[model samples]
Target: MAGGSNTNNYGGDLSEVVRQLAVVAQQLARSSINNGDAQGKLFKKVAQSTPPTYQGELDPTILQNWLREFEKLFGAVGCLENSKVGCTTYYLKGEADLWWQQNEATIRALPGFNWTKFQDKVRDKFYPSFLLKQKAEEFSNLKMEEMSVTKYYTKFIELSRFAKESIAIEKAKARKFESGLTIDLQLKLCGQVFETLDEVYGRAAHLYALELKK
Candidate 1:
């Protein structure tokens, strides 16, 4: 987010998107003490309550890509700890769309992929351009099925939009079905977050990129 040449020339939403992302990562780290508390009960309830927030096989390759980019991006801050947390495919690639975003541009830019290494090697070439350079997964892939290799990677950033939003919708539905662990728990949790995390996701630039247009 600093000024000058390295200042995310993609402009507007991109830098803001990255900044908010950094804040999110930082906040989660800062609030881990309470975050763990919030998680312990909520997760158990969410899992057993009703509709599950998570479903389907998250792409391992994409998660690795996210972890690497996370390391590269947040590494500047020196806050990201426990390589296991960042390295795990589970958190990083919770949904398919998130994985797509971590490697969307490069996958689209190249004519074809080295399928064998496609999942792992993506970590090597990540850059700002990967997220900013526009590409669509729908048109990039040649296969008829929507999830085919070529098409799958193309729509990552755009799909990232979906992946992020899906969590809110799903979580809300879960809360409604599960009662959100009673009112007291909810308020206490909110209080913890208000005191801990830097910013809420919706207010984060990544959620409002269109409004921040340069």
Candidate 2:
């Protein structure tokens, strides 16, 4: 009796042998699929174990976005404490890498390099106090007229980060965002209730799209 064969002296039966071979082949195929699935899961686990690399030059807002992604990635990986060295040098590229090289000695000399404090240092280097103030002023004076609705909203959101105290509440942020829109958009949203800045932006974007088609 070969593997997967009956004990009825089935050796002389070619059909029985063929049937057993087919069954064996099917079992092998199933095992292969199971192994492939296990390997796929392992690959995904390893890939998500580390943060994604940061590419290109550094700007205050751009670096901020990168840090946000880095935080989320490492937090998910359960390695937030190792963030200082693990997230910085390994993932840097282009101008960011050059900046790291130039400041490597000073960075290494810091007594206790806290990631949050290091972020502040990077922000200060790119967006000084004066520049933040200027951006806040610009955000305050921005109007939707003559500018595309998307650009106006994007600039508002970008500058709003520095104006932390001003747009702290969703209601206040929504009001400020609405106030910056064109009179037509304001009139369109007059009777609507928006709970967040994002909601207001959504409605305003829809109205702007309609306005464009008219």
Candidate 3:
């Protein structure tokens, strides 16, 4: 009788363990399906929105802002190659679609329209190769005398996009920004440690504003 009771108890424990594992597996499967469906729905919504138009030239600041919004939407929706098809569908219908229609020749030349690569092509088209050297030179020779602190800082950020290779590191960007400031401002900022280009800009701008008030 004792041996029989022990066998029964062991069987009950084994059944409980199996039941728990089955529940966990079912939950995991449902979660995966739900996540995929959610992403698909998001992608569809973005595919139906107004698409951005690219003229021969894009305002660097506005282009960057638009790209950021697009990246967020794309990332939320799994950023798949099929998303490129949806992008084309969304873009090819509006007046803004003129850009897509015009650029179709370039688009067809790509091996395949991967969403990320498609975005890169658009960026290259609007950013332009000739502006690269000009932007770098502008950033390198930025002067506090030519523009207000805010304007100079804004231009610095816009130009940095073109010279990303040179200012790829945060420290390099900070140093480059400081180099463009007047000698007095640079001297004032010399002892301060800054973590980002923006922080340097803010500090320099504050000092310039004080000087203006004085």
Candidate 4:
């Protein structure tokens, strides 16, 4: 049964959310593994056994990078026994997830940016968070020292809100495309991906709607 502290992973055990959420990605990769046995090893080698472009988004370079980072940032067991007083693993996980979320927001909030440029910005933001946590592991400042405590607190709260909201929206999109789940897990998975894109594009739709209302 799918269950966890829906109250939230307060202790930074992000694996629950990541595991539940990555059900789609994990299943697809697994399918490739299964096919490798049946269709010979050659076909199994290619992750995307098809042409890599649709509409305007190319596969496995930009969007795929963000997807993989999101999985790693949010979808793992975060535990660090770094005995640095209060340098808990929970804190590390929170920063990583928060980093993933801010980029998600930046990408979503861009109204007219090129997709490639948008992706580059996401990767750019990811590295800083990675470095901050690495520095924190060494009893150094988590970089919160650079800002006033109030500002740091506010930043944490803002990122926390974004991550939670984004995950909820993602889950809602997943549920929407769940109808054909029985026909084939692959199609159902594609449906979920498209559903997510719908939400991403819906932000623009919503803005245009508001402009019309005005």
Q: Among these predicted structures, which one has the highest TM-score? A: 2
Error of 3 at 184 (Å): 3.2
For each candidate, what is the lDDT?
Answer: 0.38, 0.74, 0.73, 0.39
Query: Judged by lDDT against the true structure, how good is candidate 3?
Result: 0.73
- Tens digits of per-residue lDDT for model 3 on 31-145? 9999789767765777666546434344555556666666776666556656554554354334335666787677767886566676676667566666667777777777767
1 versus 3: better TM-score goes to: 3
- Cα RMSD (angstroms) for every candidate in the order listed: 26.1, 13.3, 10.4, 27.4
Instruction: Give TM per candidate.
Output: 0.17, 0.61, 0.59, 0.16
lDDT tens per residue, model 1, 158-180: 34432343334544323321222
Off by over 4 Å in 3: 1-52, 58-65, 75-81, 88-99, 102-112, 193-195
Predicted structure 4: clash tally: 0
Structure candidate 3, residue pairs in collision:
none
* Candidate 4 residue-wise lDDT at 181: 25
In candidate 4, what residue range of length 10 has the lowest lDDT sum? 81-90
Candidate with the larger TM-score of 1 and 4: 1
Give the better candidate number (2 or 4) by TM-score: 2
> Predictions ranked by lDDT, top down?
2, 3, 4, 1
What does candidate 2's lDDT look like per residue over 63-129, in tens digits?
A: 6677777666656655435345534556777766777789877876787777766666566555567
What's the TM for model 4? 0.16
Inter-residue clash pairs, candidate 4: none
